[model samples]
Target: MLKFVKGHMESIEGIATYPMISLLIFFVFFALLFWWVFTASKRYVREMSELPLDENNQ
Candidate 1:
């Protein structure tokens, strides 16, 4: 089953670029996430952190 799938995948056109495109997308997503985490406000982080413990949340 695996061999059949691999053979079919290898026959597709421009298949090599698929991995590169996927990697670029993955890298961009994490890069943006890292930037967001660092740029987020300390007050906002504290508020989110305490949300689960806040009694009024229920």
Candidate 2:
């Protein structure tokens, strides 16, 4: 059973590399997406979090 599965996997070109590449790509994409989303809504995020900018925050 294991050998059957292994033989199938070995037959596929770059199947092993696909996961590593996709994982790295996903992380990179997610990181960039989060950065963009955060920067785009930074003011809103801060306001929602109630983080006062001044000492006597309004």
Candidate 3:
């Protein structure tokens, strides 16, 4: 199965750039997410964290 997949991938033109583009997108998304998490307000984080417990109490 791995050999078949590799053969098909090797046959495709421009397939090499696809992996780089995918990796770039993944890295950028995670970097943005990390920035957001760190920059998010403490109050907002507390409120969001308590949301489930608040619902349970009510």
On lDDT, the candidate that comes out on top is 1
- Cα displacement (Å) at residue 35, model 1: 0.2
Candidate 1: 10-residue stretch with minimal lDDT? 49-58
Q: Which stretches of candidate 3 lie over 4 Å from their true place?
A: 1-4, 55-58
Candidate 3 residue-wise lDDT, 1-58, digit = tens: 9999999999999999999999999999999999999999999999998988795666
Question: What is the number of backbone collisions in each predicted candidate, taken in the order shown?
Answer: 0, 0, 0
Q: Model-by-model lDDT, in order? A: 0.98, 0.84, 0.96
lDDT of 1 by residue, 1-58 (tens): 9999999999999999989999999999999999999999999999999999999986
Better of 1 and 3 by lDDT: 1
Rank candidates by lDDT, best first.
1, 3, 2
The Cα error of candidate 2 at residue 19, in Å, is 0.9
lDDT of 2 by residue, 1-58 (tens): 9999999999998788889998999999999999888687767877757765555675
Q: Local error of candidate 2 at 28, Å? A: 1.5
Candidate 1 lDDT at 41 equals 100
TM-score per prediction, in order, is 0.85, 0.50, 0.77
> What TM-score does model 1 achieve against the real structure?
0.85
- For model 2, the stretches where C-alpha displacement exceeds 4 angstroms are 1-3, 41-58
